[model samples]
Target: MGRYFRRKLLIYGVTFVIAVSINFAVPRLMPGDPVARMLSRNKVANPESSEAMRAYFDNVFGFDVPLWQQYLNYWAALFKGDLGVSVYAFPASVSSVIAGALPYTLALLLPAILLSWIVGNSLGAMAARNKWLDNGVLPVGYVFTAVPYMWLAILLAWVAGVILGWFPVAGGYSFALTPTFSWVFIVDLVHHWFLPFLSLFIVALGGWAIGMRNLVIYELESDYANYLQALGAPRRLVRRYAFRNAMLPQITGLAVALGMVVGGALVTEVVFAYPGLGSLLLSAINNQDFFLLQGILLFIVIGVLVFNFLADVVYVLVDPRTRLGLEGGQS
Candidate 1:
């Protein structure tokens, strides 16, 4: 267990370094200057002639420094928790910008992820049990899963928000209510959250359903499952022992999925105009807000790494053979 934890921590550390490097390198590799992008957004006379702008951009963006020095500075800032200021939302730190938008993302994503787990897994298990259900569900699920998430969001928005008028068309909350930390605020928040949740829920559920059903089916054929059947084990025992073990991979997938829920729903958030990290990321990219973009990407990378590490630990626990292998000798 000690060695296993050490291995996990070492992997995470290596992953973190790679993530940070990519966060810095990818933007620099892309065409166009960050400074120019920032200047373009401003309405200024003789935008190219300002010495102050030149100095600020050169110094802050490291345009004046050696490439290696700039890379070192970038790594230094990570230690200092200085993600730099947003080019668009100028003077505001990227961290603060992300913090402001995270609530809406959580509000939008939490229910969607939860509902997907409950409904999708249940549907998958039922389908796995019934041959007819398996035949019908696999095709329908494949169709839904194959559909682009943004298209689904739009289709649902029009049908539910416009035609039925059951949910809001766009935005995180009503413009009328001032954001506060009171009961009235919470109620308004939930009311506003409904539409985005429904949209994401519909789109996100398919993968889990298909994954779970396949897992359950595969487990049903295992030697232990056959043994249980021969022993006339209770149906519940057969499922709990055999099918549950089969579903371990899906649970690991769920952990990865949950980690991504924080950062991967950018398109959905953009379509809905919901104020979240996803929307923030979209705006940052379009406007070339490099600092904010880097911060968001780093956040996502770290989140995924942490979740993956957790999944590895869970994987070992679920299958003791994994732990035995990691211990470097036969059990």
Candidate 2:
């Protein structure tokens, strides 16, 4: 197990280096100069003033330096936890901007992902055992999974927010209410949060249900289940084993989903105008904010690698077959 983990860590380390390099490269490859965009947006006219501002902006953004030096400086700054200044929200540090937006994304993602997984898996497992449930869950699960995230978000916003007037159409909370710990504020937050959360939850719920249903059915038909039944083991006992075995893949899927939480649902965020990393990223891109874009991408890369590592650790802990395979490979 120790050797196995060491190897995994080495792989992850190499992957991180490569991913970070790609993250750094991607934003620079994009067209348009961020500094120029900022100047244009601010309307910094006049030859002397424009030149002075352009030079200042270039120096501050490290565009005056060679590409190789900039890359090296990026790594150095990254090591010291400096994500640099944002181009879109000028004068604000990239880290601070991301920090402000992180909570909203987490609030939306965590509950949606976890609850959908739990409820979907339960429904799928139940459906696997009952013919009537299988008929209903199968079609509903397919439909839900097939719907696009953005379209569902729009539909929900139109029906629930605009037409029905049940919830506010956009924003994280009501503009009138200042962010505070009061009951009124909390209630308003939840009110705006519900539609976005529902869109994510309902979409995720379908895929898990379908996947688990199929896995459970396959597990129940596997040789071990047949043999257990042949020995006159209780049907419940056999199903308990099947469900446990079927959960291994679902655990992996859960890890991957959790890993992607940092990226969030870009289209959904855009549609709802929710203040999250996804919307922030879109702003970064539109304004050619390389620092912010790379910073967000870096977070995404680190998140995926970290969560995937956790998943590997979990697989070793829960699945004896994984351990045996490792041992066999070592031999």
Candidate 3:
């Protein structure tokens, strides 16, 4: 077990280093100069002033240094939790910019992924046994899963939010409400949050249901299930055992789904004009804010790695094969 953990830890450590290297290289590889991008967004008229301004910006952003030194400085700042200043939201630290956007994304994504998994799995497990449900759910699930998330979000926004006038189509909250702890502000926040959340929920639901349905059916036909039935176990008991074993893979699927959920939520946020990491990422890209982009991507990498680690732990607890492999030192 200790060796298993050590191997996992070493692999994760290597992954982290590679992720950081890629994060740093990505912005530098982007076309156009960050300094020029920043300058273009300003109104400096004089060529001499512009030149001087550009030189100063270059030095401040460490573009004046050799590439090796700049890379070294980047690592130094990273260790100190300094992600540098944002070129887009100038003078703001990358941490603060990301901080402001992170919560909205967490709120939008976490629930959407979890709820969809729970509901989808339940429906799928049911469909596997019930022919009537299979006929109804399979087709609808296919259709729902087939729709692109952004288009579904737009359709929801137009139908429920625009035409029906039941909800706000955009933003995290109403413009008039100051972000207070009062009931009115909280209600307003939920009103705006629902459409995007629902869009994500509906889209993710179909795939889980379909996968769970197929897995459950397969597990029911497996040798263990046949043995249970041959031993004269009740139908309910056999079905319960089959569903429990089938869910092992479904749990792994949920972990994989989480990695996609973050990006999906961000895209949905952009569609809804919600002030979240997705919108922040767009701002970082448009202005070539390398530090900010690096910070955001780093956050995502960390989140995915952490969730994967947790999934490994959960798998070990639930799946006997995983623990046996660990004991055998299967690396």
Better of 2 and 3 by lDDT: 2
* Model 3 lDDT tens row, 98-206: 9998888888888989999999999999999999999998999999899998899889999998899999988999998899899999999888989988999999899
lDDT (Cα, tens digit) per residue for candidate 1, span 1-331: 7777887798789878987998888877777776776666664567456657867877866678988988898889889998888876877888899889977777777778878877888889888888998898888888878888788878878998889888776877788888888898788677667767776776667877898888887888888888989999987788776556766777777777777865547878788888998888878887777788898888778777877888887888788677768777533
Off by over 4 Å in 1: 46-49, 131-136, 262-264, 323-331
In candidate 3 the C-alpha lDDT for residue 229 amounts to 93
Sort the candidates on TM-score, descending order: 2, 3, 1
lDDT of 1 at 101: 91
lDDT of 2 by residue, 38-75 (tens): 88888966989999999999999999999999999999
TM-score for candidate 3, please give it.
Answer: 0.95
Ranking by lDDT: 2, 3, 1
CA deviation > 4 Å runs, candidate 2:
262-264, 327-331
The CA lDDT of each predicted structure is: 0.79, 0.93, 0.88
Residue 179 displacement in candidate 3 (angstroms): 0.7
Candidate achieving the largest TM-score: 2
